[model samples]
Target: MGNINKDNLLYMAKYSAFNPYRMREREMGYTTSIGSSDALAKSLYCGMKAIATWDSDREKAPPTGGIFNLEFSPEGTLLVAACEKKSIQIFDPLTHERIHAVNGAHTDCVNCVKFLDARMFATCSDDTTIALWDVRNLKKKIRTLLGHSKWVKNIEFSVKDKLLVTSGLDGSIYTWDINSYTEYNLVYQRVFHTSSLMRCRLSPDARQMVLCTTGGLIVIIHDLNLATLAQDLHGFKPNLYRLMQMSHQMIPVAAMYDHLFDSKNRENRVEFVSDFPEGNDAEVVSALQVHPQGWSALSRNISHDDKSEWTCIHDIQPMESPCDKDTRDTSPVGRGRRTPSRRTRPRVYRVPRPMHPNPMATTHIQITRESERAAAGPSTSHQGGAPISPPQPSRLGLPGIQNDVWEAAITIKQHRLLQEMYNRGADVPSTSGYTPHQESPYTSDEEPAAKHFIRQNKNRLLYYIEETNEGKGFIKELCYSSDGRIVCSPFGRGMRLLALNSDCGELSGVAQDLSQPRLMVELGQSLGIHTDLVVSSKFSPRYHMLVTGCLEGKIVWYQPFSGESL
Candidate 1:
């Protein structure tokens, strides 16, 4: 790393392509790479400059609505996208050139494109139709799937059962057998029946699926199966007003995001800021994609104020179960554990000398000794020849022919006695005679039950990242690479290449704290690349290049780190 410098720029460019955090480590002065990163770093801070590229302004084509979604081939060679122009566009991912185009493939805008395999892909459109296409022949569709009544929103493929699941605006979830295109799709009906449904996505691990709707409602189907949605299973509702309105039959961890229905200051409510002007409803999470590792999710927020578009990385961590360490602490003042021992009681600490020493009280004590000379006799003195001082009564007020201690001696003694009793009470076990750490079904212990409740109900927050750009345009898309090193998100008309500014993690994508996202490159609109709002973008899973689509029918491919034309 130290050998590669400005003098050897050619060598650095040749080998640094595979380095995941090349620009990030160069700026941060740290890396998982070998040697000191600062030695190999550049002296001048020319960070994230827009790379110069030749983009023609007169490049105009037909059916120019915009790209709705982008999907990469399983082999990472071709890129296909759903377009609002009612066509399917395919491109060579290595270059920015369009290899083939399917015009008038759908009656309405294509909403989503998903590759089934290397040679096959599926697409859904606003015309309520799903088409299966073959890469060998891009001229026509292999099969046209027609079952949805309204606009189809999303398409999910289950590799285990070889099924294609799709959801639509008509409030229906259908699963088609990909093995047999002639078979009719099965509509699984249970708790999910709403026209407000926006999109549903299966988790990367395929263990569960989350459904996001227009009413700020996010329903999760746990242990997801085709028959799981049709089963009559009871759901567990947490303590959140208007957030857990379940159908009472489906097992859903439901939570609402709308402030109009939810309490203004609800504790532990995981929701995004809403900006939609719709009537008492907002699609807070405009874009949602689970991390490929399946531990967390990446969500893009919808905002009317373009600059306030926030992106968050939510991690799903399992809550810790009840443990004995909490009940094993030994502190006495304020602790749960109760060990009955007073080795350092008040007696261990001596009370201070009285503030006001009375000389007349001392003289009176000497005079009383002479008066009781005959009364004391020989038995007054102890066996060791030391005379004992009798306990004084509270009735002996100041100057009552007795020892008159001035610093409220009676009150001090009473306080010590009360403290001892309070200590004993704290050590006392429950009526069932079980220790606090011991489990007792009949005992009144709410702590253990509360812990179990929290374990089941709580969703641990991993990290949150927000965009504070006070400029125009919102982030309509976020593309996370399959290699799990970078997260590409669009800001305004431009696009930003962001990486998790945390520890080096190659295996788990979103497992670390991603609160602080570092931007490596900015392909700004002023750079003569994407001149319009970047509505959709995709990262080459194996390569370090990114392709973005804008509203103006202009497509730009960029190298994520150097911001160069691909």
Candidate 2:
């Protein structure tokens, strides 16, 4: 409609339904009756041009092994990969050059790797331990956490709480206090799943956690901090009275529950949110990830041949009302007749009978001679008795009974003196007579009272992509883009990108009419360079590049917009 420039021409070529070639042919007076398939051909050509491509010259080679996982540092300065040969490789994303390779990083295969901060990262291995490393000095190990009895599968770091959450094949999830790198403490441990835990993901806010088990179970935990729950319940009518009552009965058992559940110890904290039904054809989930915008992506095998894998995107929807039922029964106050008990008469509640009668009290009296009492102090003696000799100064000179009586009297006097001093605001030391110990650095300070209750919606599955010819392989990993607009998974030598319908802020509303959604597949131009299956892939949070590593120890970086190999 306006003056066409080079940029407009290129845009029209890529996006317009009319093919640029067809338009040019039409301008040249080419006949439209050449074939009825012209319109379909034009659409196909447009779709082909829209597929992203990559440059082939940016491939990097590392010592050979399958790359299990890829992660970018929070600052996006370094890229790291966990390998199956007990090694870790670091690369520079911009140059596609190998930076450092830590050979023999673990005794067994390194299953997962995650960046804790800019300079720190953690790795889990089949050796049943998690090792922390410092990028600044990789010559020596930073620390090793030993607790899981089986192979560790996943590791996640909570930056806000300075905690490390690790899941193992033993079905246990362990939380560690990472405040002290050299001396980390196990803060909490629980058997969260019956089967082996496949993966664990912490939400962007670090307030929720999602875990997937090999048994096709998914568990979602909300309000990871009691303070967060306390704040969220500020105006929640249903939970207000319950939480208030819980605060009053904050006994040792309740504290234990809080530590285990990470909330007010209520049943709502941990939810058995969803699970693939038994006897269904759904495949076991192999990888799971939570988007920054509260959505989630999971990859599951759909067929027995292991060739068909599906990646499902889900939108989290909050319930209109609380899912929990009120603990109090209001039926008695409603307009309904109550049924009588089976017994003819109501049974009275009573305490259990005692086993035995109480023991009789025993009293002992001690009599001191008048001569011995007058000497202990300057108090007046009885008028009829002679002046008593001063009490012996040493216990060795007194009788056994007299010594015992005198010691009891002295102890009673000290107790009275201490109590009086305490009442008078004096500095009364502890009866145990031990100096107070300093608080440990790993201990958390009292969390501030939450101003409002944090509410989370249930996640709803939006759409799923089954295996196609271009996306055939066992899905090794799934990742979400920083903006939550796209989810990418590497299959075989190529990667599939699924664009979520996020025109609206929430994804749940766009569940319908998802037919023919945008999808992009990037297969490198190198003929045999990436013949092996891609084991790991990740999108840079700060850049437009996507990095992938394959089983043959080849790494490829791609620029999504131009599909140019970086």
Candidate 3:
């Protein structure tokens, strides 16, 4: 009670309607649900229950500073942590017991660690070298591989190809052939290179690979070839857009679908990611930017917090496109110049000034009368003077007649359309014998394309306030559970285990709608599960166990199953 300040006390007291203890009971999982008595068993459990902690005794070991990365072994029997103290420590994940220690694992800070198998694993450091080690013998080093010219940032293993893949700040992807390693000559192949490589991973299926960079680009390599992109990236030609170079004249080019090589199945053309103009946030981004990423025109962002500005990014839509306006806003025009809700807005899609208009045939022409038929009669194939259709605007305009496009001429009277919906077609009412009006003028403006909002709002959630951080906060990483149910992340000082919503409620479980992800915390004013900044975390794949390390070099173990080890 004494630790609670006036503002915090007032914050907790804002909800004067309910009893505090009862709310805590439900939040701590001490109160049973209103259903069958079977739910009562869950009441005994407190979520994210702390099992034990890993910290060095001041006299026994040299002090460790901050924790950088954590990894669990493939067999789930051991865990490794890379530390800011320039050393590596091994711990029993379930018991949180320190099993082995190496004082100087690297010349500089250890950044990342991964297990190749149960007994053998690897670690990388700022010294630009990757060291392999055997768990059985911690004192002696196995072998250190040196190929990266800059700090190695990530490590991944391909079991199918029997290869060791690593990416570094040097922007090169190296694959070390494990079967052919020699002390004198290192056998590694450089597969791909980019400007700012930061992370790399092989797909679980071993069919594809991906690399992430600092400039917010994900390079997906299919068929493992650098010469041409995979056909799978091709999709229907960027909806009503032309690919163009961002140059002085903005020269237009053929859709990149099959233009790279002789592979010419132009059924699904695509636009490139570099096409979208950068924006402050997703809301203001142009919809045409959705083509390259195959989703929304989202990029870097900075969200408004309680006070300061922090970066924000949105969820991706894999196979759908999001609209800048409501679907109902697509009406041609509103009644009596009241301004239609769908009056085309310039922000939805920005066609580069030099880019060509959509590849559509601008106009159509028809024979006006029998006299206009060509002298080659048999080729015209006019059978017994069948009723001729009315003449359409000619494809080309001669000096005397102008080919024009009219803004969808309404067929019915304005009074008749008050409660009725009408079908619109290309046939002009003026051509169908209504009193012909003056020929319309030709304009350069193209009609806007109709886009739809996603059916579920869950897919388009925009987060604010909660994800803000500072300094090394950008380097801190979070991950989903092995089964992808819970999100384990380091919030400001402590860490949070957020569970996904399973119920189908309109407001997502409805008691106190924080408008944020479901946080698994004990009831009351306790914000998270710790008091110091948690800098790194790792999860066990075969069990419901989580381990995190703080800036003070204290490692905390989180487990749901109490009293026993998995």
Candidate 4:
């Protein structure tokens, strides 16, 4: 009877399991719904002719080339797109008119396009140099930036109008000066990854530049906009003490999606650690800059704390937290919380007993199993879960697992020191080593840096211009007047302008019938008028107006903000 039961159990197990191909189909739900693979295949076959004919319509591109780079002006009016094509284009978004076009722009495909101002723009290409174009006159190139030995992938402008940033496939980024027409002494040339860099962008204020490279890595060029510090350091300080001082107390506070565990889906684990020790403090930084080496958090001292306690509160996304192989939760870990498998002595940071009764600072560590294996190699996790392949730490002198643990200890010490100082009065000895304006020497600017910030009133503007309708059919551009007095948006197939804060909300309206409004820009009163420019994705910035230079070398400037005409 026992043997028969065993045989029957084996038979059932064998019948229930699926092959690799079937498993993939089941996991992806290949043909389970209307938008399934089967449906996609049918749609592709049905629209074969349309797809072939409209394939060159750069406005509507498929994911084969991926989203190389995207940029929108602060006013959200001008949009620049650089893709696999060796050209740069701009457009009047509201009227759906192509504004400027530069063909044969590069020997290889243009990787990035950035507007330097109304007349000038910069583009990087696979041919190893950045081309500065006089978009005002699309007939000639203004200047050719030659330095990078590999494909120049991205370019950006600094806030002070002093520098031009360009990153290339060589894993190096160079900063150049417009006036000198020569390479600046500053170069954030770090070989962060074995693979080539794909994209790079400057922080709104241009303080730092972030690069996304091959191997799914990101690198943050610290002090790129060091208004004061730029006069000092030539390269990274690599302060081990500072890195150690910031390893603990920093933990992942947000929620991420998990592919496994919950059959109904929508679950993730919290990964917390001290910010990556790349020699940055919170005072000079306001947010965690995600990069290939790791993410960064700013540690600014609170003004109210007479003790000058460090009170910087910043966070970075996609932290690197590889857990031990034996660390899975039997019971589910709720959103934003984790049930750590077990606490070990080595992983815990020992704090001074004077600070707290127990004294040991407990650092919470959690690692989620990725659906796709990491490219770096096999890594371990704590959840006695399925074995996962994670990128291994480079054998070459990089910080090891032990170093991370030690750094965690130092982070706890720094936090405790800051907490103690906060408790003490401003006149205390801890504040003796520092003066009110000793270390930092700068006044708060009237116009804060150009970057994302949490608005206290919530009545402010937020710029969001992601690829819309998926597969790049169109891009949505939005801009709300400073006081929300007016709102303009390019919705599906039309441009919508409304009186958001008007009393009657019946302010004159118009909808330009179009497939999509790809870009929007407001020159502000800086343009000497209270008018805005809306251009298509293919248009380029020229003179004071937005003009479209099409494939036939035709220039067309669509007038959408002409209220009198409407």
Best by lDDT: 2
lDDT of 4 at 345: 17
lDDT of 3: 0.45
| Candidate 4 per-residue lDDT over residues 464-491, each given as its tens digit | 1211121111112222322222333322
lDDT of 1 by residue, 280-330 (tens): 122335566766766556666543223355565554422333652331222
For 1-566, candidate 2 gives per-residue lDDT tens digits of 56556644454344334444766765898665422232332232223211222222343433546677889998778988888778888878777667787988998778888888889999998677788899999987787776665567789877667778887655455666666433243333342433334567777777777766433345666656623433332222211222222222112221223232233444325543332212223324557888776655454434322345556654433333333222212231112322222223322211111112112100000111210111232121121223223233232222222332343345445545644453354554666663223232322322111112222223344556554424332336767666555556665575665554312122443445554322222312222336567667787878756677776666766653323332
The C-alpha local distance difference test score for the whole of candidate 2 amounts to 0.50
Q: Candidate 2: misplaced stretches above 4 Å?
A: 1-62, 181-188, 191-193, 226-268, 273-280, 301-307, 322-459, 468-475, 501-529, 561-566
- Our tally of clashes for model 1 stands at 1
- Model 4 has an lDDT value of 0.34
Checking candidate 1 for backbone clashes, the offending pairs are: 233-249
lDDT of 2 at 416: 54
Clash count, predicted structure 4: 58
Q: Estimate each model's TM-score.
A: 0.57, 0.55, 0.53, 0.35
Q: Tell me which of candidates 1 and 4 scores higher on TM-score.
A: 1
Q: In TM-score terms, which candidate is top?
A: 1
For model 1, state the Cα shift of residue 559 in Å: 1.8
Error of 4 at 33 (Å): 46
Worst 10 residues of 3 by lDDT: 399-408
Candidate 3: pairs in clash = none
Q: Write the per-residue lDDT of candidate 3 for residues 1-566, one digit (tens) a residue.
A: 66666644443333222334645755788744332121121221224566677677633677666677888998789989888777898988867788888889998778788898989998987676788899999897787776665556678787767778887655456777656765533466665544334466655433345544332233333333321222243221221111111111111222232232121322221212221112221111100011112222222222211122222223332223354232122322222112212123222222111112221210000112111211211111112232223233223322110100010112213313421222222333444673213332322231111121111112232322234343321245554455433446566666655433322111212324544423233221113554456667767877767788766777878765435532
